[model samples]
Target: MTKQDALFQYCLRLGDDALILGHRLAELCSRGPFLEEDLAQTNIALDLTGRAQLYFQYAADLEGRGQTADGLVYRRPERQIYNHLLCEQPNTDFAYVIARQLLFSAFDRFLLEDLCTSKDERLVEIAAKALKETRYHLAHASDWVYRLGLGTGESHRRMQQALNDLWPYTGELFEIDDVGLHLLEAGIAADLHTIRALWTPEIRQMLQKAGFEQPADDYMHTGGLKGIHSEHLGHMLSEMQYLVRAYPEATW
Candidate 1:
C-alpha cells in the first residue's frame, strides 16, 4: 500500500480498537461492582471514546471523502471495522474485564509512549494524550488483577480462567501487517516488535504478583486487522450503529 493508504489503515485500526474497547467499558457503567469503580470505568470509557474520535477525525481528513468521525464509527459495518479481537471480546465478568484491560492497556501504554515520537504530528499528539490515560488504565487493571487473584479461591479461579481464555486474543495486538510495515519504514508507526518486547515482561510480572502465571500461547486467533471479526463484534455493531443507521440524516 502507498504511504497515505497505509496511514489511513493505521488510523482506522487505532480508532476501531479504541471505539470498540470504549463501548465495552461503557457497557459496565452503573454495573461495576461498586460506585467508585463504576465511575472510574466510565471515565476510562470516555477517555478511549474521545481518543477514538481524534483518530477517526484524522483518518477522515486523510480519506478526503467527506466522512466525519462519527460517520466512520457509527456508520461502518462489522466487516469493515478493524479493531483487535481482544478489544471486542465480551465483558464476561469482572475478572474478564480486568484481564482484558490488563493485557490490552499494558501493550497500549508502551505503544503510545513510542508513538509520542512519531514523525506524524497528529498521531504523535493523539498518542501523547492516550499514553497518559492508558497508564492509569494499566495501573487500575493491575490493581484489580492483584486483588481478585489473591482475595479468595473463587475470585482466583475466575481471574485465572479469564486470563487463560483471553490469552489467545492477545496475539493479534502485535501482529504487524503490510500497512504497519509501510508506516514503520516511514517512521510514522511504533514498532510492534519493540512494543511487544517491553510489554511481555511487564505483563508476566503483573500476573506473577497476582498469583497467576502467564498462560501458554496456544492457537492464537487472528484476522481483525483484515476486518474479519468474531460474532460478538457484529452484535456490538448492531447495537452501537442502530441510531445512526436508523436516522441517517438526523443531527443534534
Candidate 2:
C-alpha cells in the first residue's frame, strides 16, 4: 500500500478504537457504582469521543474521500472497523469495565507520549494534544484499579477476576501491523515493542499494589486489528451505525 493509504488506515484504526471504547464507557453514563465515579466515567467518555472526532477528521483529510467524521464513524460496517477486541467487549460489570479502561489507557498513555515526538508534524501535533487527555484517563483508570484491588475482600476478588478475564485480549493492543510498521520506519509512530516493555511492568506493579496476583502466561486472542472481530463487534456496529444506515444522506 502507498504511504497515504497506510497512514489513513492507521488513523481510522485509531479513531475506531477510541469511538468504540467511548461508546462502551458511555453505556455506564448514569450507572456508575458511585456518584464520583459516574461523573468521572462520563467525563472520560466525552474525552475519548472528542479524540475520536479529531482522528476521523484527520482520516478524512488523509483519505480525501469527501467523507465526514460521521460518515466514517456512524456509517462503517463491522468488518471495516479496525478497533481492538478489548474495546468492543461487553462491559460485564464495574470491575470488568475498569479493567478494560486500565489496560487501554495505560498503553495509550505511553503510545501518545512517544507519538508526540514524531517526525511527522501532524502526528506530533495530534499526539501532543492527545497526550494531555490520555494522561488524565490513565490517572483515572489507575486510581480505580488500585482502589478496587486494595478495597474490601469482595472488591478485590472482583477486580482480580476482571483482570484475569481481560488479560487474554490485552496482547492485541501492542500488536503492530503493516501500517504501524510503515509508520515506525518513517518515525511517525511509537515503537510498540518499547511501549509494551514499559506498560507491562507498570501494570504488574499496579496489580500487585491492589493485592492482586497476575495471571499465568497464556496465548492471547488476536485478529481485531486486522478487521476480524469478536461476535460483540457486529452488534455494536449495528447499534452505532443504525442512524446512518437508515438514512444514508440524512443530516440534522
TM-score of 1: 0.98
**Model 2: per-residue lDDT, tens digit, 124-239?**
88888888988998888888888888789999889889889889999989898888999899888789999999999999998888788997659898987778999998988888
Top TM-score hit: 1
Clashing pairs in 1: none
Q: Which tens-of-lDDT digit does each residue in 1-252 have in candidate 1?
A: 789999999999999999999999999988999999999999999999999999999999999979899889988887789999999999999999999999999999989999999999999999989999999999899989989989999999999999999999998889998999999999999999999999889889888987997899889999999999989999999999898888889984
TM per candidate: 0.98, 0.97
The lDDT per prediction is: 0.93, 0.88
